[model samples]
Target: MASDSLLLTADFPRTVRGYAPSAVDEFLRSLGSRLDALQNQLDQQAARCEKLTADLSAQAKELAGYRLKEAALAGALVATEQRRAEVEQEAAGLVERAREEAEGLLAHARAEAEQIVGEARVRADQLVAEARQARQAEEARILDLCAEFDAAVETMRRTLEAHLALLPEPGSTLAELSLGGLAVADAPDSLAQAA
Candidate 1:
């Protein structure tokens, strides 16, 4: 692991066992060149490693952001589901209340209809009773008129019979003069029947 500066500047002692200075200098120069090439290769590798580390860090940050977005979307989905359930419950309650109200209204209407029918029936009965009373009164009045008519006819027949008794016998001149076209026997009976 000799440095390039030390290799270039190293000196050998002059002795019987020492190597030639020219040959040693040549070998040291070759070793220094090879070391410099290896160092350059190592520096290039280090630069590539640093760039790859930065790229990895950026990708990790992007992955973390995507995970956060996914979590937020899941939370939103859960909240939406809860809200939809609440709305469905509210709609069901509203429908139930409407049905109850409609049933109540129907019951009320039925009661009113029954009451009205009952009143109508009572009024009809009253009207029928009044009609029957009026018919009975008219019948009684007609019967009284018939009785008065029969009594007047009986009084007129008696008056005619008394007048016929005052008349002469059938063949008399006075009877013939008084009853112009009737026979005496038929006169009283015919006049009474006509009356």
Candidate 2:
């Protein structure tokens, strides 16, 4: 029937001067046992090969996943570097703008301060000129007053000298009285006219 069963069944015909029947049967039985042992060993070796192949396939898949992760990490690193460069450029621009603004403010402040100083100088000059003019006017007025006072004093001195010349001497007083009231009255008229 089955090939396996056919191989298990063994029939050896006996010959008179040939192999012994018991010895030939014993040899066949030992060969069957050896063949079975060899078959079992072959089956174990096939199972081990299959297991190793499966492990190799799983390892290949893991390697591919690791490669993908590495690629992703590389891309992320490149992107981070680019972003850092962009930020640095923007910061530099901002710093430049701030510096320019500060410079402009400083220039404007200097201009304003200069203008204020110039105006102050002009005002101070004006005040000094006004004070000089006032002092000159006061000096002129004082000089005029002194001149007027000197003229008044000179006029008074001349008037006093003329009045003194008109008066009689102490010895002439008796002669004037003896000459009568005419001389005394005439002397008063001369003094009044001179004044």
Q: Which digits, one per residue and each the tens of the lDDT, describe model 1 over residues 96-163?
A: 99999999999999999999999999999999999999999999999999999999999999999998
lDDT of 1 at 53: 95
Residue-level lDDT of model 2, residues 60-80, one tens digit each, is: 999999999999999999999
The estimated TM-scores of all candidates read 0.35, 0.37
Decoy 1 TM-score against native: 0.35
| Each prediction's whole-model lDDT (CA) | 0.86, 0.82
Off by over 4 Å in 2: 1-8, 80-195
Error of 2 at 56 (Å): 2.0
Candidate 2 accuracy as TM-score? 0.37
> Top TM-score: which candidate number?
2
